[model samples]
Target: MASFSGFIRKSPDARLAVFLNAKGVHAPDDFNWQSEGRGTKLVNDINGLIAELPEGTQDRVKAELDHLASLATPQTMTAAEQVCTAQRIDLEGLQGIQDVLLMLAIDHPKTLERVAAQASLMQRTGGKNWSAFQFEDDGEPWALGDDIARAGFVTDAIALLNLPEHRKREADWYTSIRVHPITGEETEVLQATIYVEARAESELTFGPSEGLERQVFQRVLEVGIACNAKERIVEICANGGKKIRDQYASSFAKHFAPQSAPPVEAPRRDVLLNALLSNPSFPTEPADGIAKVQVSSLEFYSVGGGFARFEHLGDDETIYQFLERQFGAQSPIHSTGWTITGATLRIMQTPEDGTGLSVSDDNQCRFLTISGDRFNAAQHGRCC
Candidate 1:
């Protein structure tokens, strides 16, 4: 083990890392694959690098390196522990499973240590919100707490996960490293989170199996001058720099130097409108075989916009026939009128004819009412 130094800086666009050490090596592609034996190798490699450092500095990093290696085993609370934690009775009075889980998770010794490490780094680097590169656990953002604390929000999230209909929920741990590209100096922090249904009860039956996601950040000293045109914001860098070396380079500079306003232009309303309407790409159409089918259910992964849109068909009719009738054989499906309000979808068959289906949304469509002669193929159904 060796002493690691410097502020951690993440690349704006890549998960790949570049160390500023003697070898300047990049971590193995599988550096984060904890269970697949890849993470073990990565840990070994780091240990080897640490060993090469002078004896005096080794004492500084041995423990931390060992801890990183320990994470090769995915972190999660056992069912008994989770249940117990959720049902715990404390000074707050009777707590719901969600309340217990949230408090326990936030106060998790490992999680608290990680959060503290991040806060220390932010303070050391003079990094502030939006200015510092954020580390994401999987796709979820992780951040330090504020003066009022982040407990309320974390509780709300756990409550959502513990909804009556949910079968299981899990929390997994990950880590991110920030290093000085020129010095191999570094700071690493653990980040833990659970993706929607990531470790459901069914998933845990097979033992620890969630995947680990990781990233390392390294800072490079580069200066950038920005020039903005109507369509492009070009960056000219020092030492003949032609492009932006890193997205956060400007922020890094602002931290150490007086900030200057770079040239900026607001687009005109006409330009903005044109950009929105021109060459718009509509969402992909449902698969050809997706029609006249009953929907069993929908699973939402995130609260924003919620559930992913997927249409599944029951075994009633061949998808071809449904599509052929819905869209005229010789022409594309042209919507004469469509209105989506609340949970109902009202669509007109054609401008000249009142023929279409009125679909209601639920866990599944409760009813799909057909109108006019458009879908007259089936006696009870309406199709042409």
Candidate 2:
């Protein structure tokens, strides 16, 4: 047997031939390392040799194999193709050398000399069935591909790799609520949730018409599953998936129909208050005497001013009466002349609590001193 040190000193090709011959596989007279099936055969022979070696000698053998696998040459594309072939054949069985080869193909400056070869290798190796890869962290294999894609690599390969598996899988359907931004009203949304076998589920909502909705959901689901783009999937669902629907318009054209316009948002406090006022049970008349009143909306400005719009009150109601009814009878607004235009009602003022309230010229908006427990309490009360 050739000494292991002599084996380490041999050129990569010579070492590969020797390794193969030791496993009863013959190297032809003009053995080509780049020949089809040669790289996988070489890798398998090397793995067998490592298994037969003593535990202490295994690491050195692996290191030498790593060097051989990642050896850079003017024929970078040929080398990359061989590595990809070997990895595709024995990714999990190769004792981390396969990952080393992949990283070298992707990250090494010398191997990146051929951009076309790099891209080709990425597509070939990355496009292998995604389920066959094992992620080290949480076992979500697609996440590994996503990390590669996020590093500015092509995602089409990842998409291609995951497509077949997704096609054969069944999706779970569930109802999700989408809340109106202005009204806080919730609408039930239907979502199709699909996942890689034994992995996390990704959910995407359906679109407008039944037929088109199916197409949109399927397209988004496929892409989302391919890329593991959970956040993007959620955004598309929220926005009605219009961009995606437009993408496959040819397929969806027959299913097209007019979608109902989204609810027009009430942009102003008065408009929202008017809608509340339309309710018969809502108070339209001012309280005959001091009584609790519900505040409809409050907006604060950074320029030391803001406004609170109530649902409705009798036209004859005075600012003092409104303040008393809204804040409570014992509130500081009850101080004499406090209701006067331009009057400032100071309350809870201290080194810590600097809260104060002042009437604006119109008495509709109030300038507020922003800090302190009182303001927070008032804001919290309205929110709750």
Query: What overall lDDT goes with each candidate model?
Result: 0.29, 0.32
**How big is the positional error of residue 159 in model 2, measured in Å on the Cα after superposition?**
9.2
- For candidate 1, what is the TM-score? 0.16
Give the residue spans of candidate 1 off by over 4 A: 1-143, 146-148, 159-162, 165-177, 187-190, 194-384
Q: In candidate 1, residue 315 scores what lDDT?
A: 44
lDDT of each residue in 1-384, candidate 2, tens digit only: 223332232334543455545434464576455434444554555456566766556766566445444433333434344434423333333223333343443345333322223332223321321111111232222222233323221222223234454444433332333333333344432222232233344455444543333222234332221111222111111112333322322111111111212211111110122222112132333323212232322222122233233322233554445556767754333333221111111111112233332221122232222211122223112221
| TM-score of every model versus the real structure | 0.16, 0.18
Compare the candidates by lDDT and give the number of the best one.
2
Q: Per model, how many backbone clashes are there?
A: 13, 0
lDDT of 1 by residue, 1-384 (tens): 222220111111121132213223334565442333434454455556567766546654454323322221212122212223323423244233222223333345454344333333332221111122212123322223231223332333344334443434443334444332223334443333332332322222222344543433332221212221212232222222212223323332232122333323221110111211112232333442222333221211222323222122434543334444555543112222221111111121222232333343222222332221111113222221
